[model samples]
Target: MSILFGVVFFILGSLIVYVFQKKIFKGITEEDVVCEVVQKAFIRVKNSEHNEHKLVRELLKSDAFIKDLSLTAKFQGSIVGYILFTKIKVGEETLLALAPLAVLPKYQKKGIGKSLIEKGHKVAKNLGYKGVVLLGDPGYYKKFGYSSASKWGIKSPVKIADENFMAIELYPDSLIDIKGVVQYPKEFGI
Candidate 1:
């Protein structure tokens, strides 16, 4: 009986590690643009029935979707994390906005979101985008080099805390003279 119990315990422990290995060593890439798979993953992560699900669906359909930077982070052949970067018009200038970043609830706080964001910035910069703006927790986003939009004289169209609306110039001084109310596409419903 003792030997049998030991074998069972070992098997269970191995299974747990195997499951989490995918979460830890997932691959981040821009190749996957399957909007349907991404939309389903967003719904599962948010788990708010249909409303939250519909939001992702609409964003995927929006004209703002930048096919190049809408990235998916896959674990074991499944998309466990996703980040969408869209073009926004700030006065006559255009820049990217990181919106609707979603990671599986089970996968949050494990660096999947961070990896996606970092990878998105690298790709966006390579594609000649000047900067990126996002409405998110300053504490969380600041780690990625984001600063207050107000520092650059930029503002969000919707009224929100100054800190929550952040921007990062992909290259130094990219936002120096680019200042205006950041205008999101109408699909955002704001």
Candidate 2:
């Protein structure tokens, strides 16, 4: 009976670790991951335009909309994923928004993006952020508690499809009675 119990406990422990692998094995720090993440995002963005690195660098440097954020992932001694958030203002209130999150082509589907986002939210909540906004796939972001910003009377400053713009309130009533345009930093050019 003792041996059987030990086997059962061992299996259960392994299952727990497997299920929560990312949280259990977070191996990268914010400082170590930023440059690599920026580099990966730049490569992906460059395909869409000339001087993409310059443009992204300018955006990161100038954007006041990004705050209380950091990048993280399992490096395996090389950068394989990245995520970023910046601060944005809606009317008189400020909120954090996730933007331009990316992972290397070979690294997608490994739960890295989800891990970064989940951990990022915890950190933001710890820092007393009330809400998080993002423009992304409804299918993907919805899984993370994102909902249409329009429901809260929040819209992007630039013209964009309503479905692509979403926000999640980390705190109860974070968006209560708050409604206005979502403004990005000048570097975003939108």
Candidate 3:
């Protein structure tokens, strides 16, 4: 009887602590992208996303996965948001593409996704990446300095709308005279 009481008390205490910690760290900050965290967060966030879950799994295995440039946001060590960048080629110039950026459905609109992208860009630039590209809403991505890739004569290997495929230069003139299809690694399966 005493052991049963003790177990009940312990579970109650854990719940209280979890709630308290979440409230205290509600607006979590960016953290270095950990692969395990990304995988876990993907499981949590992938349902609301358009990319196939299998594709995200495959990306993690790609040789081009720029693990160091990825970013995540956590609340009390629980990954709430993530952004991944992988190597891509546009003609002879190599760059990075932001793909599968996600935040837990419940955590959306709290600035977690925004922070991950901002941090990813900074880290990617520091790593000598010429630029970053992505396919997403222009209205949302434009705030992050991304403009239509067509402005720079860049096209996606697959046929995607011009406004949806965007690019941002990390260095001045990085896209100068660069015109061609943006080819992702075979692992991307696109």
Candidate 4:
């Protein structure tokens, strides 16, 4: 039908216009912008904390904060995406935890989140991190190399589905010997 053909063209058009800037998040100076991005990104999620901006504020002040792993994606001089990977405890090893990755509602999909994750992984690998863990949609995260945490004996303190609680090694065999319940920072209130 003509309507179906029109829908296809619209989808392709949106993808063609998707582009953004990504860089190490400027701490303190850009905190409010990042908070605002987080707010708008999750405005429709029924189970979202709905106050994730507050969590980001607390995490920034926590010892787990990692300046280099904090990244933002900007489009046309305005921040449109943000991703924070903080330090977390896994038995004796210290790994990164990716949380609250946000992309503005209007900008969702179109590879913004994908690019941010790829960049974060590269930076994390260079920083000598073993891997990154997160609770997110497995279908999406898996496309970026994430797998069930249980595959490496990693468990979450809070109950969650195996598929939703996922992780990705930064490099080959990085998590081969690591295994334990993740100890999130106090800021997470877990």
Candidate 5:
């Protein structure tokens, strides 16, 4: 029975690691995989220009791109998810913009998106970034502690629902006194 239990434990450990595999996104070589995941993830969104993959490509070449904050999740060594945090300006301070977070459709709802987000937040905090902003679902992002940007006096550069525009400070009160319209890279065209 002990041997059987040991075997079960080992199998479970391997499965966890396999499903949660993540790493810094290597450039160019892995671009296609990342783009594919982005497009696939947004395919079902109503009127999703479906050009998020293009945005990812553009962000990669933009000055705002942070190489260290771009991450990928893998399954069995194949890239299955991607997330990017790019530099954005709020007032005079530089924070982050979380964009194009994507997971292959088949891989959705399995904690992969949450894992990428938590991992990105950790890396951003380690890199000294105080906060991040994004345009996304209120309910989904709220799970990660994202709240209305308006609460921090931050406004959206474009006209957007207050709830859809959100921000999260990496640490307590990190976004205090940070108030302004978020300036996304021109690549965003917004």
Candidate 6:
């Protein structure tokens, strides 16, 4: 009995130490951080329609698109959060679309998603994007300056919740009077 108890305690203590080390010392490399986080998030979402892994590949390869803005959080050298933004065009105007924003199950509620979105927006602004549009929970995106796309005459090609389709103008007069169907990439299948 005494020997068995000692073995169990040793195993439990090692497991705890490993988790703590991962939580404390991990950091993501600037180049691969976003991809890693997105991959992990895809596993968590388990969405059949988007095939999140494929989407990431296509987005990275598209020449028509601008930079893929993403952010990631890491612990013990593993990414725990992610967000992705790609270019979307409306008529002659250039804008961006946010999609596949996610965080690891263990890291949810730690402001990882918020950091990703906020930093991505700033990067998009710097790169001269006029605005960003996304289909997401209003309660969440609204805090990041998103408003209903209907307000600006922007509409999704497919049926989506009215309040869920949202946009935010990066420039003061960017989307003012500019209204048209949002053309997402073919990969979106809509």
TM-score of each: 0.74, 0.71, 0.75, 0.84, 0.84, 0.74
Shift in Å, residue 159, candidate 6: 1.2
* 50-161: candidate 6 lDDT, tens digit per residue: 3665676677667544554855567788677766788887777878888878787678888888888888989999988889999888998999899999888888888888
List, residue by residue over 1-190, the lDDT tens digit for candidate 5.
9999999999999988776664334344688878888988999989578999999999999999999999999999989999999999999999999997899989999999999999999999999999999999998999999999999999998889999999999989999989989988899999
Between candidates 3 and 5, the one scoring higher on lDDT is 5
Q: 80-176 in candidate 3: lDDT tens per residue?
A: 7777888999999898989868777678888988899989988988889888889888999999899999999999888888999999999898887
Model 3 off-target regions past 4 Å? 1-51
Candidate 3 residue pairs that clash: none
Off by over 4 Å in 2: 1-56, 63-68
CA displacement after TM-score superposition, residue 39 of candidate 2 (Å): 6.0
Q: Which residue pairs clash within candidate 4?
A: none
Assess candidate 1 and give its lDDT.
0.81
- Candidate 1 structure quality by residue, lDDT tens digits, 52-100: 3455556667888777787888888877887889889999998988876
lDDT of 3 at 115: 92
Predicted candidate 1, C-alpha RMSD: 8.1
Error of 2 at 22 (Å): 30
Best of the candidates, lDDT? 5
